[model samples]
Target: MERFTPTRYTLTCVASGREFEDEGWTLDDPECGEPSLVRARYAERQLNVRDDAYGIYRFCDWLPIRRTLRGSHAPVTYKSRKLAEYLGLENLYITFSGYFPEVGARMTTCSFKETEAYNVCARRAEGEERVLVVASAGNTARAFAKVCSDNRIPLLLSVPEDNIGALWFEEPLDPCVKLIAPCCGGDYFDAIHLSNLALSSPRCYAEGGAKNVARRDGMGTTVLSAATAIGEIPDYYFQAVGSGTGAIAAWEANLRLIEDGRFGNKLMRLMVSQNAPFTPMYDAWRAGSREMLPYDADQARADAEAIDAKVLSNRKPPYSLHGGLYDALVATDGDVLVATNEEAREARRLFEELEGVDIYSAAGVALATLIRAVREGRVERDKIVMLNVTGGGEERFRRERGNRVWNLRPHRVFPLDADKEQVVRAVEELFA
Candidate 1:
């Protein structure tokens, strides 16, 4: 059997409509004047699940990767009886991406970011000399660090110092994986800026955030799992977003499923949420603006600091980009919702009590919005709904692992305004 084979797919720029082949990590078409995401056009029109494969690769038919790696886990979807009854809806389902062994969700990182990590790393060409740089809040750093370490892929992660606690791993990472961070008081956007400066090195390439086709397609597997489990696409899809990348991925998956002719031909209305005080996307959507209104930098940082869900703290998200969350919302008749810290906490407690699993702050935000939608009569009781538990089973996973878990300490720390040349030179030396 061939260990490596190219996925039969072509790439299309969402802005220019230019079609091209995958170059492993192509984020956009430079020929197009406007910045936009490039989407994958798979040759396999029908969704095909490969039984021989494991983890996210089970739905590899739609992913943009030349190979699959070890220790990958797919999202698990199950009908929600307890939560469904509590919410008074008949067709409610939970698509979970974490370490709930009872449901067979074996993501040790205990975050849906594993979905993005696995696919993105796999999309890189084998033995590529360039070191991949990624910016993250915390969960994403943990996910990418683990995946790249496991697969022996060279990677550099820039994470917010405040959210560094989220980087605990099941074991020590390989030397090929390195971690860095903006000093305390910085946020996700700061981490992104640090990584951007590091990208100035010719030896480094960016693992594009929302712009990465591999990442969006990777996250799309959550919808694929739900559709395959429920036998059709749900009437609505719910999740919490910092970048709104997962929601866009869900919408893209819905399009592919509709084209597959197996799942029901309907686009699931994306019901995405954001943590209160840091809700730029929600604010933009509600104000009916294509562009994000001027948000003071100090105010944005202050608001981000006030939110419990620190991971949902991207001040500059892909909301206004072509084929981004804005287009996704408009195309699917979606609505952006906001949840307060108090509301999200209550929702988390309720979910754990009813569903018997702890979830991340972002998942709590998602559940809180679903509750709000129910109370506001935005969602009907009888409609099929999928509530995405982006991350859960953390307490349980950690408890089980015990002393085996280790935190990924940063190799270097920089002030928010660190010089670009300084960052680039230091980053290059790590791989040198």
Candidate 2:
């Protein structure tokens, strides 16, 4: 596969309809004034970056560059005729990336995390000068480890201690990639704290977290890849969002296509789903502001701390950035759905019955949300739709592991209230 090496970045201002160089940051004074977005564009398209001063860069505008390094876990599906006829849309396609024998399964997830790895690593300074710090739960660590190890990019991943078990990859993570699960019991947000500290190190670079263009752009390939397979992008975009990085990526991809004069900017209404137990975004959307409710974050964190899927819940979502995902929702008149545990299971069963596939829990939320949208009349039956099955490799995969799992744990731990200097000492132990 061919990879792009661009010399400069592109800057765009959505509200103003003018684009310029992203010498640094761009501000948006929303006439709406409360909780509006001001975005920073890096290139003509999405670009994933790892710069010392920038923390993360050009990730949004250049997110599309991410699709290059990933392998598929599912197929571009058009077999949902029942769904298609029901949606009342002309073209309906399913972007499936899971573990079924048909789709290639990587070690970490039934869904394709490979898409994230591909884009994150593709746009980097040549000669291996960059270091990426990934904050994940289990699956993302495993996925990123596979990608960084394959690309020989150094990655320092911080995951919650309990979530470590799911870090198993189809193959052993490459030695160059560092794994850092918390030594104590907390949650995904706790792990993110560690990653934030790691990023402050001169030797380490953050994956841009939710802001990384690579993650959002690369993940959007599920949409683009499906669109190419189906001959058109859908009028509605459906996905289960923890961080909602993928939905943002999809919106950005559709924007780029419009800029390329190929696809219309009439994006599919982004129908996003979240686990009901962790529906901060849902609550915020319901209340009519993009602001995060402090009580919801505290409550959700405390509740999810007891479980392993906490990584799927991000307290701070990137919804209000200029041209960010929240903006996408407003522009498309999108709606948010919260999936109950029962609904997720039912959706999973329904999917397995109709599509002959078992999806990840997150994907189940998406499928369930889509069903809810359909049943509740939020989704017009005649509109074109696209559903992104982010991952499902765990249930559908048939591949034998090429390697064995390793007994791993956090490299070190702080007091959870440890200062920066203490964290710095911990990060230095992994240095080459």
Candidate 3:
């Protein structure tokens, strides 16, 4: 039997509308100064689902990668009868992207960020060997560490010391992965700043945050999975946003599904939520502006610390960027909702009681926002709704997996205000 090879796709700038070959891990177009996010353009317009394939690979035709990773882990969607009844909604689909074995969600990192890590690593593997550097509060680092380690891909992760607790894994750490934490009182943004300084070397490459087309399309699989499970696109898509990249991915995926002509033409209303006190995107959307208003740094840090969902505290998100969260919201006529820490806690308890599974704090914020939307009549009870539980199943996973989180210590921990020379030296030593 001949091996089935997926067609290679081209990268097109969302701003200039110019196309480029998928020669390597390209993030931006040099020709356009304000280049928008790049998208994968495949020759196959209609999605050809491979029933024989597992997880997100089933939608390989849409993803940019030439091959699929060797994992069945992907977002699993199912009709939520219990939660729907509790919220008084007739049609509610839950896309769980965590370690819920009952629903077939096997993301051991317990976050949808795993989807991005797998796709990004696969895309970069096609090119010359180079170490990938990532900065995260917690979940993203864990996701990348797991995927890169499993694939034997070299990776360096920078995270805040406070968030180091969230970097546990079910299995032992791979030798190919290196970790760095800043001991000085810092936040996620500070970690990103340190990572940027470290990436000055030619051998190190940034994971490209929202700028990376592979990461966005990889995350788009959640929408595809939900649509496939529900047999059609939902009327509304709900998620808790830090960078709003996932929401943007859903909008992009919805556009592709609509182009397929199999799904309904209606665009899914993007109803994204942010934890309160640090709701930059929410404030911008409420004010009818694309630009995020300047926020006090100290106050922002305090707000971020106060929230249970520390992952949703990105101060410098891709909200105002071209073809970013702003464009996505405008294109889909989306609304940003805010959830307080108290509300998120209450919602988490309710969801655990009703759904019989523990959800991450960020997912709790999303659930609270959905309930608020239903109460405010922003979303009709009968309309099809897809709620993205971006992370969950940590407690259940610990119970089943013997609470064995990888305890590999960091290669080094730098001060919060580390100089550029210090960061460069650390990167050099990491490779040496």
- 1 versus 2: better TM-score goes to: 1
Tell me, what's the RMSD of every candidate?
1.3, 6.0, 1.6
Instruction: Give the whole-model CA lDDT for all candidates, comma-separated.
Output: 0.91, 0.63, 0.87
| Residue 71, model 2: Cα distance from true site in angstroms | 6.4
Write down the TM-score for model 3: 0.96
Error of 3 at 91 (Å): 0.7
Q: What is the lDDT for 3 in model 3?
A: 51
lDDT (tens digit, per residue) of candidate 3 on 111-153: 9998898888767755647789999989999999888888788
lDDT agreement of model 3 with the native: 0.87
List the candidate numbers ranked by lDDT, top first: 1, 3, 2
**Backbone N/Cα/C clashes per model:** 0, 31, 0
Cα lDDT of model 1 by residue, 210-260, tens digit: 888889999999999999999999999999999999999999999999999
Q: TM-score for each prediction?
A: 0.98, 0.82, 0.96
Model 3 clash pairs are none
Candidate 2 C-alpha error for residue 280, in Å: 0.9
